[model samples]
Target: MGGDPISLNQDADLHLYMDGEMEPARRAAFEAQLASNPALAAKLDEYRHQQDMLRLGLDMMAAVSVKETETLAGRLRWRLDMDRFSRRVAPLAAAMLLVMGGWSLTVWVQSGAGTGPQLAGEVDDVPAFADEAAEAHSKAIALNTLQPSPPQVEAAPVPMQTAQVPLPEGHVMTVTLPAIGPELTLIRASIVPWNHGTALQFLYREPDGELLTLFVASGGPAQDGTLHTVVQDSLRLVYWRAGLVAYTVTGNKADGDLLTVAKKMADSIRRS
Candidate 1:
C-alpha cells in the first residue's frame, strides 16, 4: 500500500486485519495506509469477489460431475440387464430348436417313410421264425427229458443213414438213424398235440434200406408195455424209459435192428 503492490506476506496480514484480529496500533497504521492507497483497496475488493466466484464455480462443477456419474452408472446397469436377458433366452431358444428337430424325426419315423416299415417288418419276421424254431427244439427236449419216466435200454450195433419225416401243418423234419456211425445226420424235430403235451420224433434210416422212427411222449412210462407191442402192419417198434424220459424206436425192419439203432443213439447221447 505504501509503494508498489503490497508483498504477499503483507496481504496475508491484511486478511487477518479484516477479520479484526490485528493489534490496535497496527490496525490504526493499516487504516492510514489504506486511506492513501485507493488502488490497493480496489485490489482487495476484487480478490474477495474472485474468491467467492471460485467457490460458486467449484460447487456447480461438483454437482455436474455427480449427475454425469449417475447417468453413466444407469446406462451401464441397463446394458448389463440387456446382456443378462439375452443370456437367459439363449438356452431356451436352443432347447426349442432341439425339441422341434426331435419331433420332426419322430413324425418321419411313424409315417413309415424311407423304408422304416419294411425294415421293421423284416427284422420282426426273422425273430419270429427263430423263436418258433427255438420253441420247437425246447419242447422236444422237454418231452424227451421230463414228464413220463423211462428205463434206459442197452446199446446194439447197426448201420445208419439220414431221413426226413412228414408232420402235421406241412412241417417236415429230417432224422438220422441206425443211430450208428459218426456220419449219421439227425434233424431234431418236435410236435405238440392237444391233450398230449409234446412228442419228439427222430427219423433215421438203416443201411439195410429200412426206415426207422423214434417217438418220445411227455408222460409217465407205460406199465403194461402195450405201446411197445402195438404197431401197424410190418413196422417194428420198441420203447424204453431213460431217466425221466421215454424213448420209442419204430421201424419197418426187424425189432432187433430198431433196438440196435436206438441203443447206439442213446449211448452216443449219454457219452456226449
Candidate 2:
C-alpha cells in the first residue's frame, strides 16, 4: 500500500489477466517479470482467483477424442492468446493458469481446439527442449545425408533458390533465420512435421561441412534467459523459450562455437 495509486492499477491488471482479457504481449511480459520479482509474484499468489474460461472451452469441445486432441508439439505452435503460465516462474517454467479443471486446453488454428491431460506440473515428465532439439537435428541430418539415395517421390519439386525461406504460418513465428553472418550461415529454412505437429526448421552449414539444425516450435521446456546447452552423443543443442515460441539450435560443432551461434540467433530473433 506504499504507492496506493500504482498498487491499485497493478491489482486491476491482475484481474484482467485472470479473466483471459490481457493482451498477449503484456501478459507474457508480466509473467517474465514475475520470475525475478518475488514480492510481486507472492502478492499475486495470495489472491489466486481461478477463472472458468478453460473449463467452458473444454465442455464445448469434449466430443473430440484424444487422437484429435492437441499433443505437446501441437500446443507449442498454438496462438499465445489462448494460453497462460504460472506467475511463480522459476528455473523450470510450468503451466498453471491455462490448464484448468484437470486437462490443459490447447487451441490451434490449424487443428480445432481441444484439451489434453499432459499438463505441465510434473516436471520430470516434460521433455527437455534441448534434448528434443538434438534428436530432431540428428534425425534431419540423417534423413538428408545417410539416406543419400532416397527414392524420389514423384511429388511437386521444391524450389532450391530462395534468400529468406518462409514457413506455412511464417507470420506467426518469432524467430526467422538470418542471412550469412560471422557466427553462422543460413543454408535453408522450411517447415517440417514433428510429433504430428509443425516445426520451423533452419539448416545451416558450418565451414567444416557439419550441418547445424535449428528448430522453432510454439512451446517446450522453456525458461526465459540465456540459451541452455545440452549435449547428447555427437550432437549439442542450445535452446530457449520466448513468448509462444521455443527455439533450439543444435549441431555437431564444438561447444563454444555452437553456443556463440545459438546466442546470436536468439538475439537476432529478440531484436526483430
Candidate 3:
C-alpha cells in the first residue's frame, strides 16, 4: 500500500494474476493485492523470476527434441539411398583395378636380368622450372634493347593559349573529355590551351561560381613533328588528338580569348 494504492482496475487485476491466466476469483484478488503491497510484493517477485526463466528455457528445448528427431531421420535415409550406394560400388572398383595390374606384371617378369625395386629418391614436388626459366630468361633479356639510341628526345615546352567563354544563357557545364573521339559538341566558343609536351595550368573559378579544371599531356599531335597546342592564362587551354586520347581544356579565360576558343575547337573537330 504505497499511499493511494492500486486501481487501474487494480492494475488489470495484477496482470491477470501474473499471467497464470487468472480466475480463481482472479487468483484470490491477486493474492490479496500481494499481501497488501510492498510495491505489490516486489512486483510479484519479478513475475516469479520471469516465469522461472521461461520454464527453464522450455525444459532445454524438450531435451533436444528426441535427439533432433533422430538426426533428421538419418539425413533423410541417406538421401533416399544414394543411387543404391553407387550401384553397389562401381563393379567392385573395376575388378580391384584389374587384379592389381595382373599382379604387377607377374612381379616384373620374375625380377628380370638387370634387377628391379630400387626406387626411393623422389624429391620433386613440382616448383622449380629453373625459377620460371630464370624469369623467362630475365624477361627476354629486358625486352632485348641492344644498344640503339638517340630517337626519343621530345621536350619543347612554350605553348599556352586557351579560351571558350559563352555558356551564360542557361549556364550548365560539365566537360570531361579525353576518352578520345566522337562525343564532341562542347560549345561556348570551343575553348583551349591544353599544351602538350608541357608548360601547363588549365582553369579555375569555384568560389562557388563553379568552374574548375585539369588538362595534362605526354605527347600529342600524334608525335612525328608534333603540333597540337593551345594555351590561355587567366583561364583557357585546349589541346587535341582523338583516337589514342589526348585532350586538354583549362580555364581562367584570357590569352586572346583563349586562343580564339582554341581555334574554334580545332576547326570543329577537323570538320567532323
Best by lDDT: 2
Q: Candidate 3: lDDT over CA atoms? A: 0.40
Clash numbers, per candidate: 6, 2, 26
Candidate 2 on 10-119: residue-level lDDT in tens? 66777777668899989988776566566666666655622256566777887565632345335445523233332235213324334443223223311222221111
Provide TM-scores for the models: 0.29, 0.41, 0.16
In candidate 3 the C-alpha lDDT for residue 34 amounts to 73
Find the 10 residues in a row with the least total lDDT in model 3: 113-122
Model 2: runs farther than 4 Å from truth?
1-129, 147-183, 220-223
Off by over 4 Å in 1: 1-180, 192-194, 221-233, 269-272
- List the candidate numbers ranked by lDDT, top first: 2, 1, 3
Off by over 4 Å in 3: 1-4, 8-10, 13-37, 48-50, 68-70, 73-272
Candidate number with greatest TM-score: 2
In candidate 1, what are the lDDT values of residues 1-272, reduced to their tens digit?
Answer: 34457767668767877667888879878877667677667666777888789989999887655654576578669867976997899689768868777556444433434321111111212222123223443344344334442443333533444445444566654433334563333433445342334455654444542334566543444232211232333234455443434556555553444444545555543433
lDDT of 2 at 40: 61
Report the lDDT tens digits of candidate 3 across residue range 55-94: 9999988776565457657755874596478679858965
